[model samples]
Target chain A: MYDGIVQDLIDELGRLPGVGPKSAQRIAFHIIQTESFDVDRLATILQTVRERVRFCIICGNIGEEERCAICRDPRRVPTAICVVEEAKDVVAIERTREYRGLYHVLGGALNPMQGIGPDQLRVAQLMTRLQDPTVEEVIIATDPNVEGEATATYLIRSLLPLGVRVSRLASGLPVGGDLEFADEMTLGRAFEGRRTVER
Target chain B: MYDGIVQDLIDELGRLPGVGPKSAQRIAFHIIQTESFDVDRLATILQTVRERVRFCIICGNIGEEERCAICRDPRRVPTAICVVEEAKDVVAIERTREYRGLYHVLGGALNPMQGIGPDQLRVAQLMTRLQDPTVEEVIIATDPNVEGEATATYLIRSLLPLGVRVSRLASGLPVGGDLEFADEMTLGRAFEGRRTVER
Candidate 1:
């Protein structure tokens, strides 16, 4: 809808993960109109990230070095490893400040319908990490959806023979949410997992 | 929420026009995971756009040359110039294939509340363009909102002295839209601008 170079810019912006056509147009125009916007700096950052960033060899999480920050940190618990579906999941868990263990990104969960199975994920790397006798437990923090549950179940089966404790993250009504608006599955989980209140 | 370089990438992405924190995180993860996505090409396009592209000297639209594609096209009707609020509006009108003429981007609408006045836009350039005796008409295609209306009114007043025919794009119920769902202002305009049917 524009000259070659302008159209090229829009097309490249549209190729990003979530930018739709209208949004891409808006952003392209924004870049064109805003005189103070430093497009060259953004370009340099993109180039640098592509050139320097790499996945951690120990886990699948992103890092500029050989291993992820959590994996390199001495304070992170070596005995406990939380398995998550993506690197973004590691960020989300980190925001909670509750967990102090290392992470292993599975890239994605097992979705047989989508042709993603245990072999497609970083499951083998996880199993190898578990080979150490010092590691006492593996926490499956995959999503509560069908694919995530399937992946967690498969991991449990694989880890049973290794004699390490395996646990799944809890699924229930979210905090600050009312019971009336909770979905059926969440309401049921809330009931099944109810704990005694201490006075 | 991530390692140093990954966090820096997210921060830069978040500074873009419409990307929020959550969207920034999502795009960062997508860039990291999709090995096939050509980040280098995107970076190159961005750099090229910054270094090579500039606004058309004649119309204020983005262009690789001194004049935009429309301004350079020999076949475009020179007499009819479509006045729009931004470069994005040029793209929207071009998609319709209805306006076969030149364009004059005002850069922004008049919003006195925000301290934007005629001097802020390319209004002076628009008036200077009308000095050419061959130009016969100026079509005001600014937005339908209050700020757009104010800008159009100001342009109409400014162009009256030049004796060139000043027109406005019709505003009413949109094509394929239900009359019942039309807003009161649009429904009122639709009745006010009712045209006689030809037999």
Candidate 2:
């Protein structure tokens, strides 16, 4: 047990994903020991983000305005839209600098056990966006896990009838990882997606 | 790279102690996805703590007013004071429900490499507190590691001249711990601190 304020902080931190009770305690204690200015800055930013930031009306990505930057950028390819499970996935894909298209954040993947389904996601809005005459392709960039795979499959089936070219990101062994340590599914995918080497 | 605001949030989270860039990224994403009400609650509490909490002038623990609850409580023995390095240490000691004395938070332990000396600590304030006529005993509850041990030794040397009784927390094997698995120092401490059982 800890002091009331410290316990409150730990409880709030523990509610975060991947943060256990021990981690929450450690962080709470660290915050208590840190300078008040630093803690105030963090608190200010936390409040500012919640107050000034919101999901883009066009795509579910976070932004200060109604639409995300990519959605407003004329240079980005409006013909193709990459769909992801969360706003973070959009950032992850952007880091590659390979896509020149817009994004549609589904908020979360379909997890029946968690009671999250297609109705709970922004799938209907995505369908509405696909109705634009300029749109041609939809890239499903959901995570390669079971839930992600299920969501992608469901989206592909639904998008096929709309006459849009639907695709999923390839799955394989990670770069810089040893082939010997690769799991069977990843190694198999790497073999299946093998490309010809240029001399 | 993420949106500027998202990046700012990640950077702020990364500044927290023990939170690496990867962990910060994870936490930032988790925060973004969390329910708006939960995020708002965290923001509110963070602001409340920063605005309302202040250090107790007497014991240095966080509180709303001049003195912390522990220091203000008349039930606690004001005649004895336990010295510790940080406010978190005071909370840790209180959880045991063993000692019933007031506390003196020294802010940090003595570390020569880091250039932290007695001058940087609250040792002077502790001595001032000891000058009170009713004070009879001082408990050196600094940590057991190198810096803590050094601090305890320093406190013992400094406090002995004041004619006040000084005691260190007993060192021994932890309750419910295996004797064979205990480290040599712990096992030796347990043997040295062996007590007669009332059979």
Candidate 3:
């Protein structure tokens, strides 16, 4: 029911993971109401990023250059690499401010039902990278979901023969959530990873 | 923790109404993953709409030219006009096959707390439009909220002396809503609007 350009915008917005038709319409109206200069700047940045940004050859993170900033940073621990399923995960981990290691994006997690296998990921590339004597530890930071766990299991099995230290992110009850409201998996993990109180 | 361009994109996306920082980050990542051609097209359209779209002088609806499509259409009934709070409301009414009348978008509803008054709206323009002898009826289709009710009341009072028929959209139980679970206001409306059944 919208004009041609507006409809195109709504259609494109609806293609996003969580945005629905109503939300697409709302966003389109918002964009239409915004000032020309502001909208134009957004458009310019979108186009610019599309033209300049590409996956980092070393770690698969998004970057305008051949190497991502994390890959090139000299202060980052070269001996330790954190493996994740996607580039977005790298950003998530970076926000925590705890990890100073490098990253290796696997492109996607293994899902045999959807035909995504080990070959589809950068597993071989990761194995080759680990062959370097400077690399010491590999931390698997995939999502705590089924596909993520399966991918981590596959990685651990493949990497064990290489003699590198392998680790996975600890699972437990999230802080601030009520125990009664916690899901079975989380509660089970909390039980498994329980710690003794020293104080 | 993100690169400067990615942060810029996230900030810009966050400026849109209803889009939080987390949603903005997700949208930015989705945009980054999209093909260059698709991203360029969306960016180009955003710029094009910003540069070309303008408010119709007579009706206040968005248009590329001086007048909106509805204002230019000769077949629409000139004797009756549907007044709404926003341009999106006009689109919503047009989707139904019911109304063949013209439209008058009021920019926004009356709200004293928000500093919006009749002067802030297109009430003066609406009055001018009604001055034409061809106009006979004005349908107030504002939202079913406090601000909309106040605007409708104000319009009815103003238009009574002009010798034009004024009507408000009926408020009652929604089509898909359960009568037993409906709120007091909606249930009260349903009772007030009760009609004799033809048994």
Candidate 4:
């Protein structure tokens, strides 16, 4: 519905994860009309990211080098590895300032419908890392969805024989969230995973 | 929360319209991981759009040349012109295929909160265009929101003494919208502008 290059820019932007047609148009217009928007800088960054960024050879996290920053840092605990669905999940976990261990990015979770399975993920790489015998625990931190749960189950099954402790991130009501708004599955999980308090 | 270039890319993407930090991260990751996404093409288009596209000098609509396609067309009625707030609105009106006239883009609406006034818009250029004896009518098709309404009102006051027909697009119930779900203002407008139907 727009002229040549404007429409082309919108079409490319619309292919991103959450951008719709209207949003694409708005962004494209902002780029075209706003003089201080730094079109060259954004375009340069896009080109640079494509040329520079790559997955860490060890954990599959995004980085420029063979290993990501966390994997390269010797201060982090190598004994405990937090396994997650993607590199984004690693960042989410890192934001909490709780986990001091390294990470393993699975690339994606198991989805039978989409034909994604054990072979599609970095499951073999994870297993190879566990062969060191120094790693004591593997914490599965995939999303609390069907595909994530299936992936966790599959990982648990595969890691059991290696004798390392396997654990999953707890499922329950979110912090500061009202119980009334909690879904049935979450409420049920909260009840099932209930812990006793000291008197 | 991320490394150098990756974080830089995310920060840039986050500055776009409707994209928050999380969405920016997702888009950045999509660019980094998806080999088939064609990052070079998107980046190249961004650069090309900035280098090539410019607004039509006559009507203030975006195009590659001195005047936009609509302004250059000879078949469209020269007597009637649709005055809209932006180039995007011209596309919206054209999609309906209901109007067969030229367009005059005002750049933006009269937004007092944002310090936008008549001088900030293309009001003077519109007046200059209307000076031609051949022009007979002006249709104000700005948005239906507060700023758009204010702009329409301002345009009406300015264009009244021009000795040409001036009209605002009808405000009422949307075509496929339910009357019960209509907002109070819209319902009131519907009643105020009610038209008699012939059986």
Question: What does DockQ come to for candidate 4?
Answer: 0.76
DockQ each candidate and list the results.
0.65, 0.42, 0.57, 0.76
Candidate 1 lDDT over A1-199, as tens digits, reads 7887778989988988799877787787777767788887777777777788888999898888999888999999899888888887777667556678888999898988889988999999999998888888787777666677778778888887888887665556464432223455554454344332211
Compose the digit string of candidate 4's lDDT tens values, residues B74-113: 9899998888888887876676566778999999989888
- Candidate models: Cα lDDT each: 0.77, 0.74, 0.76, 0.81
Go through the candidates in order and give the C-alpha RMSD of each one to the true structure. 6.3, 6.7, 6.6, 6.3
Model 4 residue B76 lDDT score: 91
- The parts of candidate 3 lying over 4 Å away from their true place are A173-199, B173-199
Task: Work out the TM-score per prediction.
Answer: 0.86, 0.79, 0.85, 0.88
In terms of TM-score, the best-performing candidate is 4
- Residue A29 lDDT (model 1): 72
Candidate ordering by DockQ (highest first): 4, 1, 3, 2
As a whole number from 0 to 100, the lDDT of residue B78 in candidate 4 is 96
TM-score of 4: 0.88
Residue A196 in model 4: lDDT = 24
- A28-137 per-residue lDDT for model 2 (tens digits): 76776656537666766776777777899999888888888878889998898888888866765665556788999998889999999999999999999988978987
Q: Which stretches of candidate 4 lie over 4 Å from their true place?
A: A173-199, B173-199
